[model samples]
Target: MDMASALASLSRLQHPFSRQRSGWLLAGTLALGAIPALAQSTSGVDGVWSGTAQSNGQQVPLKLEIHGEGDHLQAALLNGKQRSASSSGSYTDGHLALQFDYYANSIDASLKDGTLTGTFSSRGRSIPFTAQRNTKAEPSSPNPVNIGGDWEVEVKSSKNESAWTLHVKQSGPNVEAVIQRIDGDTGSLFGEWRNGQYEVSHFTAAGPSYAVLRPQADGTLQLVTPAHGGTTQTWTARRPQQARAAGLASPDDPLQHTRLSNPSQPLAFSGKTLDGKTISNTDPDFKGKVVIVSIGGSWCPNCHDEAPLLESLYRKYHDRGLDIVELSFEEENQLANPTRLRAMIQQLGLTYQVLLTGTPDQLNEKITGVEHLDSWPTTFFIGRDGRVKAIHTGFAGPATGDAHRDLEKETDALVKKLLS
Candidate 1:
């Protein structure tokens, strides 16, 4: 059977959570309306529904675009340029449901008098959600200020203090923004300048994320981002050089953050494939081949982004002695069913060998060869001689623009070097 067909078969394999389906991999589109990459609000219960999910008492901006009506509905969650359409959708009795099967995540709410009130839920965690028709936005500023360029952002919460790079490209009122950290970026966030502040949002099968920014008098930007757990975080951002000059650290290079404990030692690891077959480095498929071993989970968004690239690379170089293996560390429930992992493999058309390891928390403990293995999508390159060559700790996805391209190019070059 074809990949999609196989995925569909696996999806049909029932689970305890009836609402949990591989929504990201399902293929059904409804042309209810058009929500451009950069968009404003529209009227009715079907168009673009915009609002905030309560975050630690703060609000994070989000946009839900729904088209069609009744039993046949097309819906997508919008966050800047990142638009994730529902794999499954329904509308009945003034109630709407959109499920992104990939993460077993769903959004269910009731529509009343042009308003939507409900909750976005995953596993056992639920976040209160409420939105109204995204009304047409009118720029309050006669001259929309330019908040373009690279910004050095600093998050100041009692729990976490980290530095991030914020990239923004603006043309008049439209804006495209993202935050790049040591591990990966937050994907694309598209918004327009409205009122006196800037608002951007992104939602996918992974969940919802929204940020609001206002320029301050001291030439800095006050950033408020609503995150999971119903809590919002306020941060400050300035130019890259300025932040660095003020002692704000830069993001660690992806290739330099994670490394092998012994460069000359061969990576000794093995895990069980879906069907319960154990594959190891000594396997014939891996012996004398240049292998790329990726450590990540199906629930991770960055891993979702990196899977396609890994698949593409494998297809391109597999005949030339390139071998790729993915060690998936998923939730315990997934270990039993693996519907999401199956969907990802089918959606990406990955032909590489995939094995089920433990969970994400078991990463460091399960793999004894590496240090600083904190990132979800770390990649290890093994040379033909069976020695470790290089390790990349994080993923720079397409949403990162040039950085992502550069990483791909660098990887290709490194693989070529290892093969030679």
Candidate 2:
């Protein structure tokens, strides 16, 4: 079946929340109406707006913060524990436009009656969204619980279990946090404490998520997440005495220990490039070269974090026999695949090749040649002889701070060993 058709069929079997999250994988266009002034309010669009965005039968709360005015305006999107700034924003002719260059997403909406109505577009899909200007004063906390420090958190759900490092800072009731998962950081989540509970949220073109932390009797915090379709998951976290680095696996560690199975096998796969050219593991371009095979997808936020580092490594070591190939397991839209890939490559200034593999399920079956893959952006390091040297699963993006630096140092050392 064609990729688009396959994806459509797969969506029917997935949970409603999953479908809503994956809607951006489809191909479509956003139709925005002309902006007309409301008779009630002539105030410029500068301030904080809070409301819920309904998409794919799910409602996610969002906050839009606009600063400055006119062409000099800047904007930030907030959901739960995520915040992303616009590449550029402008308010002109009663119209609002915000461009997120990182995800190839855009928001075009019109303001009327203290309400902003528009469509959020990513890849090729468009979802309707609305926001109402918040007029209430910022809430203050008389006795705010200090959650500053590093915490080791575990999120367990029926479908998945994962670990995360939550770094929290609080000044009075103002709270700022960053969640470092195996994949990447959750960006900056800004919110305030209320009634002894800490709350924060972030929204982006991809989707929305939030967290509500309530102190437990054992000194740990319970993170409650309300999932779409009436499901709820809780993450429990405790402050560790010492802060540790982020990332699932360290680069200095032995690669064999990180693999789930089949550590000694040479990587093998054949796929078409984004340009429709067929390529294989045995291609002449990769012969005798130290290869880094990146298994990821455009729809993955963690993959977005890892792309720039890969691009840097490629540019620095390509002449020294380093070759990188991104084996992307994209959404089932074949037509949208290239567009998303190209956007990512261009945004990161990546020169390495990207091969369009099938869906995550297909790629897991074909590439791993064993059990299903466990994570997004699993990187395979292949020696000059084309045998797998090590497999590093998951990525700790820059949000991990020192952890990210340590990863770079380890990667550089490993490359030196392979080249020597």
Off by over 4 Å in 2: 1-108, 119-129, 132-137, 155-163, 241-260, 334-337, 370-372
The local distance difference test score of each candidate is 0.70, 0.64
Instruction: Name the lDDT value of residue 132 in candidate 1.
Output: 75
Output the number of the TM-score-best candidate: 1
> What TM-score, to 2 decimals, does candidate 2 have?
0.74
How much is the lDDT of residue 76 in candidate 1?
65
Question: Per-residue lDDT of 92-120 in model 1, one digit per residue for the tens?
Answer: 88888887777778899998877799988
Candidate 1 TM-score, true structure as reference:
0.82
lDDT for 130 in candidate 2 is 83
Q: Residue 388 of candidate 2: its Cα lDDT? A: 78
Q: In model 2, how large is the Cα lDDT of residue 242?
A: 26
RMSD of 1: 7.1
Q: How accurate is candidate 2 locally (lDDT)?
A: 0.64
